[model samples]
Target: MSAYMVGYARVSTNQQDLTAQRNQLNTLGVPEERIYTDHGLTGTNRDRPGLNQALAAVRDGDTLVITKLDRLARSLPDARDIIEELTKKNVKLSIGGSIHDPSDPVGRLLFNVLAMVAEFESDLIRARTREGMQVAKAKGRLRGKQPKLSKNQEAHVVSLYRGGQHTTAEIAELFGVARSTVYRIVQRTPTLN
Candidate 1:
């Protein structure tokens, strides 16, 4: 059977566009119909459905195409695992139109280096995000979700509960809040004699 190309693409966030990658794959000669994609999924995650489908679509003598190594996998181990699978299936990997030959020592080395760089970049991004969040929290700018009710509203709800004139559901509906909120207010507020 003649060899064909099956393409895979991924973006880490919903806001990120896949047009550039798609166009690159198209330029690399992979048909649009054969291209598979995973949106809003990080490369570190190995269980993406699109990746699985792309792998499954390729058969012996077929080629798997990607715009970049990082788009396939971010970590060295995952990259190696994917390469191994492709090798076993007698399928080839084309990164930006360049075929990866696992049997070649230099090619393997280059692939590993690329995978390591991708992993390092991912780690750096995670660390920076954590540091930013810490700074925000220290400045009290990261205060969690605001209360659903104002202090006066909470006091009124508690008073209504204490008065035994309304059910939790009734109070919840009256204030457009959940029954759980009314229950929480009742639990936290002190009972007056």
Candidate 2:
């Protein structure tokens, strides 16, 4: 059977654009109906619905195309696994205008090298992020999400709990918060007046 081209596009965040990837697929002659997209989904996330659908729809002798290697997968292992599965099914993968044919020695080598580079890039990003966080923490600038309830609201929750007039659910409802939030407020050590 003649190989059919299937395209996949992805963007990590809602703010990131997918137009360029779509345009690339269009330039490759992939019909609009054959292109799948996962917007606001991270490459590291394996549960991309669009990717899954594209893979499922592809048959033997079909070519799966992506604008870039990272758009297909973030890590080496995931990329290798996808390639292996597709190879087993006689499907070809084309990334960034290069077709990675498993039957060709050079293509196989290139695919492996590129996959490792993508994984290394991801690891570097994580390491840099951790280093930045450590620096911020040392400067007392690293902080978690702001508390949902204000100090007065928390005090009111504690008081209501101490009075035994309201349950945790009641306190949560009264304060427009979750039951877990009410429990956390009550469990914390009270400040000395």
Best by lDDT: 1
Error of 2 at 39 (Å): 3.3
The top-ranked prediction according to TM-score is 1
118 Cα displacement, candidate 2 (Å):
0.6
**lDDT of candidate 2 over 94-133, digit per residue (tens):** 8966788865678778888988898889899999999999
Task: Write candidate 1's Cα lDDT for 110-193 as tens digits.
Answer: 778888998898889999999999999999999989999999999999989888999989999999999999999889988777
Model 1: which residue pairs collide?
A: none
Error of 2 at 169 (Å): 8.7
TM-score of each: 0.90, 0.78
lDDT of each: 0.91, 0.87
Local lDDT at 174 for model 1: 98
lDDT of 1 at 34: 99
